[model samples]
Target: MDLQLTNKTAFITGSTSGIGFAIAKALLTEGAVVIINGRSQKNIDSAVKQLQAFVPNGKVSGIAVDFKDPSAMDAVKQKIDQLDILINNVGIYASKSFDKTTTNEWHEMFEVNLMSSVKLSKYFLPKMKANNWGRIIFISSECAQLVPEDLIAYSATKAAIQALSRGLAQTTKGSNVSVNTLAPGSTLTESAQEYIKNQAIIEHRSEEDVADDFFKKVRTSSLLQRFTQPKEIADMAVFLASPLSSATNGAVIKVDGGSIPGIV
Candidate 1:
């Protein structure tokens, strides 16, 4: 389980917390150099401090840039030249009826969710190709296939990412560079934990009861029948980012606890 990732440089977007942060920690555990990104220096510094506590001597750094800004990638380029692994994990969503989702909302989701990966890949994929070794992982979601009514815009962006990832992998052909997507199910991140806690208080029920209702009523197809932990998703992401996963290119690997039914 060495992952052979020592000294590998990884950059994860939106990694100040949640699954992105978990991925950064996992990579650091494998002895990889990680540069985490967030919108502000305060968040990045906090996350880096927490990561160093977990991985003691881990090499970690941060880049604070808002991917929503068109000029954000330019700032990133100035900070780092190349990467052995690039994880497009930053995303935002609004849970609302499709009709109520405005044009600006749709544009914003696409810009943050899909275009961020597009921009990052456009810049780094060639560098990886030239170096003849790299891994690009797009953090997609099960919503892409489930297409829940409340998350149509978000789901659309995730679906687009799958196509984008596969096409990018095709360009790698015979190179050591690989492009792949991971579709995770409802994971219990910090935000999700707060949501459960809030719902429990509102419903006058225990947090456990609220979580049970989420699986039974909201995500009825989940075989796991509970919220997945961020670490679960991060474990798979770190593996995919490693040189050990060289043969897994162009695949939409699911760590969705069987919420996505049927064999592919």
Candidate 2:
């Protein structure tokens, strides 16, 4: 179970909270030097402190960059020199009717979710290719396949990531570097828990009932019948980031709890 990740340096986007933060923690546990990122300095500092507490002797750092800003991304690129692992985990989403989604919203989601990864890979992939070793992981979503009506923009961004990841992997044909995408389903992060609680109150039902309804109605294809925990998704990410997963290139691995149907 040694992931063979000791001393490896990893940069995870949007790692101040939620699943990104969970993945950062998991990587650090495997002895990787982690760089956690967020849009705000406050959140980045707080996350660094929290991670330091968890890892103690482990190397942990932070970078605050808002990918939504082109100039800010340039700054971020300057700050990152070389990395053994690059995780494009930053993303934004908004749930609304297709008609209600504006062109600006679509652009914003695509900029933050898809373009940010493209820019990062453009800068770091060559460095990795030169070294002949690296791991590039994109955090996609099950909605890419499901294409939720209210999340058309978000789903499009996720689908774009799958294509981008595979195409990038092709460039590493005989190299040790690997690029892959992980599509996770509804995960019970703190924000998700809060959402469910609010929904339960609005519907005048118990939180358990709201969760049951999500699986029974909204997500009928799910086999797990509940939200996957952030740690569960993080475990898979950690494995994919390790040298042990060298053979798993140009693939879309699902940690979707059977929510995405059909066999790959």
Candidate 3:
């Protein structure tokens, strides 16, 4: 399983923590030259240091660019003319009732989750086409289909991602380049773990009990009956980034532990 990714360069957004960082680590393990991104210089530096410790001899770099700011991405564009792989992983979400969600919140969700990918692909996809080879992975979510009532805005953004991914994949028709989306379900990142712990305290129940109740009452359709680990999702992304996944263009691959419940 060489992955055939040695020396290939990759750029991932929001790589300072969580799923982004996990993907960066996996890519590095496969010998890819990885450039991580974050919103602040301090965070970027910290992530770079952490990654350097793990991939001592591997090439790792970082850039501070907030995708929400138009000007910030210009700086990012200047640093790299072309990329072998681009992972549009940066996103923001707010969980509130539709009546409580404001217009600004909707705009912010679309801006960061949807528009950022559109802009990045516009700039880099042509270069990929010219070279006749590249990989573009959009980190979508199971929410696109699940569409939780409290997460309408977030679900809308995720649905837009799937549509955009398919449209972009069409452009790569005869080329070696490929564009696809990876939709992951409830992954227990540090933040999620903290939230669950807080729920346990508030509900006067054990953490395991809280989790079990969640699967039974909230996510009853889930066959796995538990949260997925970040590394599990990262492994799928690593494979998608590699040359080994040549035929998977224009597809939505799910690492959602059977929570999505639909066969296609």
Best model number under TM-score: 1
Candidate 2 TM-score versus the reference:
0.98
Model 1 agreement with the true structure over 175-238: per-residue lDDT tens digits: 9999999999999999999999999999999999999999989999999998899999999998
Q: Sort by TM-score, best first.
A: 1, 2, 3
> Which 10-residue window of candidate 2 scores lowest in summed lDDT?
70-79
Whole-model lDDT values for every prediction? 0.95, 0.94, 0.92
**TM-scores of the models, in the order given:** 0.99, 0.98, 0.97
Two-way TM-score contest, 1 vs 3, winner: 1
Q: Model 2: runs farther than 4 Å from truth?
A: none
Candidate that scores best on lDDT: 1
Model 3, 186-229: lDDT tens per residue? Answer: 88887889989999999999999988888899888788899999
Q: How accurate is candidate 3 locally (lDDT)?
A: 0.92
Positional deviation of 176 in candidate 3, in angstroms? 0.2
Model 3 worst lDDT window (10 residues): 67-76
